[model samples]
Target: MERFTSGAHEFLIPMVFYSLFCLVLTVNVAGAVSIQDDCHERRCNNHEPPVRFPFRLQDQQPPHCGYPHPGFQLSCSENKQTLLKLPRSMKLLVKRIDYDARWINLYDPSRCLWRQLLDLNLSTFPFVDEIEPAASYTLLNCSSQDEALYKGNRVDCLSTSASQIIAFRSDGYAYLDNLLNCSMIGNISAPISPYFFRFRLKWNKPDCGDCEAQGKGCRLKTNSTEDQTECFYIPKHRISVRERLMIAGIVLGSLILAMIFIAVGWRYYSEKKKKEGLLKIEMFLEDYRAFKPSRYSFADVKRITNHFKDKLGQGGYGTVFKGRLSTDILVAVKVLNNFKGNGEEFINEVGSMGRIHHVNVARLVGFCADGYDRALVYEYLPNESLEKFIFAARGKDRSLSWERLHDIALGVAKGIEYLHQGCEQRILHFDIKPHNILLDHNFTPKISDFGLAKLCSKDQSSISMTTARGTMGYIAPEVLSRNFGNVSYKSDVYSFGMLLLEMVGGRKNIDDTVENTSQVYFPEWAYNCLDKGEELGIRIEDEEQTETAKKLTIVGLWCIQWYPVDRPSMKDVVQMLEGDLHVLTMPPNPFASTDPTKMGATIPRKPVNRELPTIPEIE
Candidate 1:
């Protein structure tokens, strides 16, 4: 019996050895299969919410070893002492993991309570299955009025200190009230198992009907219940692979097309700007070439003008210096003051006068257009402007005879009429006061200073303006109001009328004070004297002087009707000065008194006949 038992033990030992060998082989095979199935191209578990491709773990190690998305890649830290390797920016702490639910409860220390997580794109990672739809919370001191909207559904808050259960469907994570007031919420704390809650998941197919009813397609279930299964309502409008590729191709093509358009537009704009600049330069050169005024360097100008020794007159634009170009040729050199680097007035005067050649208009001999220095050279006139003679209170030596005054008036009228009708473009002399009308040695009037002159085509009766551009009292009423007709050649007529009045008054038309008498406008005072058959206080003592002054005053009054249409043209103005006085009547007072002090003195004057004169046709 002992020999038989020994032999059986020997047989049992061989059987045990063979069974152990088979078991080792089976374990090896299982391990190899797990490695082949789970191991990805690279290891990538340590990213943020989304993990990238080419990184995974062996099947035996667990699916959580990789990220949830394809592009979020992770690399092993050089210091391999840490348990879970992660990026420097990821503020995450894994509190618990449920094996049955295949879910992890994590706390993000960087989370914001009211902020939404949808802005973060989580699809790049692979290991992170999904992000939870709702944030976890606990009801503490929250009042009943406090409500939370979760997954498009509003949930009311219960009483304070009540235990609350908030479950997130996307990651199948459940949160519980450990201590209502002391619960970890938002980015407050990193939770451990003692305060953490986990979920228990069951294998359940997603109910796609609810998603379909809500116009959405079914996604993988993250959380499931006994009766109702969990699902993500994905939109049905997802692009197909081919459509996605086509879209990408279209986007690239569109970008190329946009680039082409941009390039074309830029080239066109650049060329256009270049052409405009070149055109401006050419025009400036052409207009300014012939009359280049001997390129007087600052020193030459100083020498020619004798360092401004012989000043002819002082005016708003600048001072005029009488300089001698040669012993035989004397010139009037006007040196303009700087107007904040705006040489527009200087350019306009030079440009306009250079293009014009008329007996009545002053000729532009030459000009300078240096950086800050501007000068205009003209043939010197022996006599000064009409204002120095006619309007001076004490300068009787310079006073003109009635015949000379008439000739001067006729010459000035012809000049203005020429400006209106003769040139290719009509020139409106905005500053038409006596100061601008100069007299030569023969007492012939020549209109000077085209600085404020505006050039317009003959057919254009009116011009639009942004601002009032003329002497204050001389500006037409129509220029100030839109209710009046378009500002036309009529505007110049109005200025001429004012000028005629000033010529007759031998003083400014608007001046109210005279010696010691109460304030009185020259026009009103003259009209009163004429209507009452009183003397005009003529400085000259002759019957002819009396007749000339009366005729001049009447003609002046006839010209200065308030409305531009009521005033006479320059043609009629000359005729009235030359024609007999008996045919003329008192013109209607256009500028009737507006001041209360003069209201009682106001008297209406009758209008003159409109179509009475036939002066020479303007050529």
Candidate 2:
């Protein structure tokens, strides 16, 4: 009895103690999640906003601040850049993170895109490169270029320096020497041009769109493996597979019919909107009507425009006719063409303009989308566009006063500011040149033309754009190449900066007639002037107007800074323009070329003091 008690009691006592310790540990771990606030917002650098639990900077963040261990960890470099370490020895220098959209833009700091591409192991990492082309080429760093083996195009870099990576189509892949050299195939990427030092990165995360709609911040659902995120205030959406299948079928059938009708009606009239104008868009917009008002019929449009007689102007889309809505009200009826490419122009105007209303923004009074006919009715500005004023014959009497131009700039800034923040949805007018700015009888500038507008949530970090938008001179660097930066409202800000510079110099940014090579790009010229305190010798009406020109030039320089991070927001732009001119300082040059010249630059070479003096006419 004594022996049995000694062995059994000792074993049972120790086991019970161990079990109790395990229970307490599990409970404490669960409590750690339940007891704390959902987000601990942290800003890694000035360029990025406050990041939370899912993304934590290494060494800087406490343990349990972000994900516990391996996943979602980032390291800060000496330059204050956040580094994303991927599996299989790949590193990405993070430029910015859109926490709401869960999109991250990265690049190789060394400016060697080829090295990063060669080391990539896509299967090992969760990131997806959507902005880049789906195609990639294999580069063989050889002792010498063999005439026979060199089937692919030899990348011409900055004269002496050439790209090691050779671009080869699948047809040319067979010509490469596989056995003679160490052939390394790059991963998914853009064309084998000069390295631009940028890549777009995206990660798969739980959908928090609904959660944000419920006004709750997203959090990692504690102790979960898959579908680990949840909105703090709202339950996660879950539906059975059968229900999902049924819903998919219904959406598909509806889309198919709508696409067919829109395709058939392509030859009719309505201006612009190429890709987004697929008839299937009505499904999304119908619910959005709560965000809009009444829709006008094609007959009403014809009647309003007096049978399309009073023509105001004509663009790539269609003709704008000035019409009288009533004796007291005048309207601009823009009639679009039939099918151009897609119907993005029609979709852009009605979808975006109808939802927005501001003193600075042109009011979308009504619209006509009758089959094969689309027309947008807007408040008429008797003074026409800011174009006639800013580009007013250099010295003609029609040229606007400097004070009035200042007011127009401020008004446009406020309008863009409202578009970016005041509304329920942030609208990015990819085209923000002077042409899109209409002046009322009182010279109050109203932003018009939603033909290239994009709607995004106010909190979203970035929005994806499939194709480039806007006129040539006003297009931002990032809009054409993702390597410059992610596309956001900042793209519009860049355009605005160019517009202001044009106002100061009284010339188009890309004008070849300018005698000075540095002045060809108006923004760069303006920067040089302000940087050196050289007075912009424009036709000034009054002595005080010089101060106004200085202020606009300084703000324009700041807005047109090469990187999006260096540019101010529309909100900030308004404040700067409204503030004292003496306090404003010059910004870094916007035309400073970071990468080597690409293969096909047509501009003549001149030794300019600044960088990229002439804008490359990239298609």
Candidate closest to the true structure, highest TM-score: 2
* TM-score of each model, paired residue for residue: 0.47, 0.49
TM-score between model 2 and native: 0.49
Clashes of each: 18, 11
Please provide, for model 1 over 47-101, each residue's C-alpha lDDT reduced to its tens digit, 9 standing for 90 to 100. Answer: 4222211123223234443333322223333342112223333423333333223
Q: Which regions of candidate 1 deviate over 4 angstroms?
A: 1-300, 338-349, 482-485, 515-519, 532-534, 594-619
- lDDT score, residue 453, model 2? 78
Predicted candidate 2 versus true structure: per-residue lDDT over 344-366, tens digit per residue: 55666476667676779988877
Q: Each prediction's Cα lDDT score?
A: 0.57, 0.69
Runs in model 2 deviating more than 4 A are 1-293, 338-352, 515-518, 593-619
